[model samples]
Target: MFELLHKKINEIISLTDEEFNYCRTAFTPRKLRKRQYLLQEGDVGKYQAFVEKGLLRSYKIDDKGVEHILQFAPEGWWVADLYSFFTDEPSSFNIEALEDSEVLLINKSSWDMLLQNVPKFERYFRVLLQNNLVATQRRLMGSLSETAEEKYLKYTQTYPDCMQRVPQHMIASYLGITRETLSRIRKQLSEKK
Candidate 1:
């Protein structure tokens, strides 16, 4: 269980065995079955979860009852509602398991302790945040300016694993396209290949 976390952390920063063993104490493990809610809208987001297995997604339901996916967390990814976690506010997003998932969770207090104890993690999280911002900005730009086909192609290029694991309608929601449009795009792309 800690192996994947160790590997992921090592990829970003070096932590000695003694340091890692201490750091792991800050986190608690949780497992959720497919379709289960990890964080619900209106709830205070208490934990930032690191994915050790399976997949999770954070999304919102509009007044029209439409689901707009914000992000997906697969193995080696991190999932949380940053706003709620930091501000003690209610979460606007709902995080749900797309598949049965195992995650290591740390609350704000434990997270702070870990950072203070293992300063290297501050750097690791900084890098993670920077990359997330870049991807978010790019995705927003694409949503505003790119054509449906272009967006679909980019989505596939960006998250090929999600293409395999997520449902078709949810994929359409993520791409900000209609199910019929996604179907058309997929068919066209398939023919081209």
Candidate 2:
């Protein structure tokens, strides 16, 4: 159960077996059914979930009722409303299981405990936050400047397996383009190949 967690953490910082065992104690395992809500808008985010199996997405519905996907947490990824998780405030985003998933969850108390007990995790989390920030910045810039085909191409490169897992409409929503536009872009790209 903790194998993926160990691998992910080790990718950032190496840990002894004893240390890894201690780290795994901070998490609680949970299973979510497809389309089930993990965190809902207006609710305070209680836990940050590490995906052990399957997929989940964090998104927000605008007043116009269109969903804008913020991030997709496939296996080995993490998902949470960071603002709400840190501030103990209501989250504007909703986190849902895109498929039946198994996740390891760490609540604020457990997170604090883990960090306090294992200082190396501070560096690990910092690296993760830094990478997330960089990705967010790049995505923002891409949204403002890149053409639809460029966005789709980048998305495909960044998440090579996502196209097979996610539906076309959700992919369009994530790319900030219309479904028809995505289809056109895909067709054009395929024809060029």
Candidate 3:
């Protein structure tokens, strides 16, 4: 279960075997059922989860009660509301399991302890956050500028696993398009091919 986390950490910063073992000891493994909420709206997010398997999504409900998906984390991905996790503030978004999921969870306290004990972890997390921010920015730009077909293609290319696991409507929400529009776009893309 820690294998993915270990690989992810190594990809960012190489750690000695002892350091990897020490860092791995701080994570708590959990299994979540489908539709289970990890963090709910108005609740402070207590933990950042690293996916061992399955899918999870974070979304916000609009005033009209429609869900606007911010992210979908599949196997080997990390999911968290950074603001809520770091500041203990209520989160505007809710994170939930889209499929039965296995995850390694690190709470704020544990994460702080790990950072203090393993300074290399700080570099790893900083890189992770920087990459996430860049991806978020690119997604925002695409939402404003791209057509539905382009967005769909980009999403599939980036997260083909998520496309397989997530429902079409949820993908539509994430793409900032109506379900009918997504259907039409998909049909058009298929016809083109």
Candidate 4:
């Protein structure tokens, strides 16, 4: 269960066996069934979950009942509402399992303890945050300026696995395009191929 966690950490920063053993204790393992919610709107995001198996998605529903997906956490990825987790405020987003999944969860306190005990972990998390920020910024820019076809193509290129695992409507939501628009784009692209 901890193998993937160790590998993911080592990919960012090397850790001694003893150090990794100690670090592993900070996380709590969880199994979520498909359609189950990991984090719900109005709840405090107490845990940052690392996906070991299956997929999870963080999204927000607008007053019009439209879902705007923020991110997808497939195996080897992580998901959390950063604002709520840090500030102890209610989260605006809901995180749900897209498939039966195994995740390692660390609460804010555990995260702080891990960082304090393993200083290299700070660097690991910092790198993750920096990449997340860049991706968020790029997505925002694309939503503002890119055409629906361009956005769909970019999404497909970036998350090819998600294309198979996620529903078309969810993909459209993530791309900020209508479902019909996504269908048309997919059809056009398929014909070109």
**Per lDDT, what order, best first?**
2, 4, 1, 3
The residue-by-residue lDDT of candidate 3 on 73-160, one tens digit each, is: 9988999998899899999999999999999999988899999999988898889889988998999899899989899999999888
- Best by the lDDT measure: 2
- Give per-residue CA lDDT, model 2, range 64-111, as digits (tens): 999999998999999999999999999999999999999999999999
Instruction: Return whichever of 1 and 3 wins on TM-score.
Output: 1
What's the number of clashes in each of the models?
Answer: 0, 0, 0, 0
**Model 1 score (lDDT):** 0.93
Per-prediction TM-score, please?
A: 0.96, 0.96, 0.95, 0.96
Checking candidate 2 for backbone clashes, the offending pairs are none
Off by over 4 Å in 1: 191-193
Task: Tell me the spans in candidate 2 whose CA falls farther than 4 Å from its real position.
Answer: none
- In model 4, what is the error at residue 172, expressed in angstroms? 0.2
Give a tens-digit lDDT track for model 4, residues 1-193: 9989889888889999999999989999999999999999999999999999999999999999999999999999999999999999999999999999999999998999999998999899999899889999999998899999989888899879777899999999988888998998889989999
| lDDT of the candidates, in the order given | 0.93, 0.94, 0.91, 0.93
Query: Each prediction's Cα RMSD?
Result: 1.2, 1.2, 1.2, 1.1
